[model samples]
Target: METDKKDKLIIALIIGIVIVLSHNFVSSQKSDDLVFENISSSLDDKKQTKLINNNDNKEKNEKATIKKIHISGEINKPGVYEINDDYRLEDLVNDAGGLTENADLNKINLALKLEDQMRIIIPNVNDKDNNENNMTSQLISPINQNDNKKVDINTADKSELMTLPNIGEKRADAIVEYRQKNKFNKIEDIKNVSGIGDKYFDAMKDMIVVN
Candidate 1:
């Protein structure tokens, strides 16, 4: 009877040990699975943060960009200059190596605020009066005797300008804006009015006049 009792006790101890080990194994597996999930979530969070930071950087870069302004005529270095949008005309003049000794500072206000796509022309001090006379003369072109072939752009409406070849509504409106700020002294002076270039002027040269 004692031998049977001892066998039962031994079997009971073995079964208890197996049960404890199985419970511990299941708990350990659950802990490892939870750790793997937490690590994956952390990686995803880092990637999202990186993407947000990149977008913020790009936005800052776009806002902080400089503007383009064209500077020509009578400066030591006359060319297209890229400058800060808030910069003044004085700053742009200095950038172009100040001005030539003969430049007529009286003609322009250096304190004028700068804008994109602006063109500045520095006049000569000595010949300024003579140059003024020449400009007036160009504006007074006597119409060609032939059936009024030349279009007087200075007095022409937008519709009249659009009648010329290569001069669409945009170019025609640009002419009006330019003429508002600057009197077209000569028919050729239209070339200096931003969008009108050599090709466009050449295309409409024979068909246009200044008066």
Candidate 2:
């Protein structure tokens, strides 16, 4: 009877140890699942934050970036320049130092869109060859022909005086200085200069006069 009691006591102790170990194992599994869930949530939040930051960066870069344009041909200043996306043709013209005095603004479409390496051509008032020829013809033609034997250097324009053969801006200017200094009495007084001789005076004798 004593042996049977000892066997029962040993079996009860073994069963209590298994129950305690199983309870601890279940609690450990729950704790591990919660830790994994927290780690997964942390990783997801990091991904979302990174995605948002990238989008913000892209927007900022787009706003800060400026496009450069290369323009040439017939502008006042032709070269490479940078302009914002909102800038227009008028703004570009101003940045390029505006147009030349001879530039024909009426012929071009100033409101047209610009592009990279674009050639902005401000055409001449007329066709190139025709314009040049017209200018030459106008230059050769005389204006208000003087019939008397006098030349008024002070009042006459440089172009008018330069119409004489072999006369240039410098020589015309010299004649004006001579007239101013001596207050010419006759047309022969112009012969005092080195380049202007009696022959040159005779050639221009009919073309000039004085009051």
TM-score leader: 1
Writing each residue's lDDT as its tens digit, candidate 2 over 1-211 gives 9999999999999999999999999999999999999999999999999999999999999867756665444467877788777766678888998877776565555565554433343444543322332332221222233434344654676776676543566667777777677765666676785556554454455556555
Location of the lowest summed lDDT over 10 successive residues in candidate 1: 135-144
Per model, how many backbone clashes are there? 0, 2
Candidate 1, residues 96-130: lDDT per residue as tens digits?
99888887666666777776655555555663222
Candidate 2's C-alpha runs over 4 A off are: 66-211
* RMSD of candidate 2 to true structure, Å: 18.9
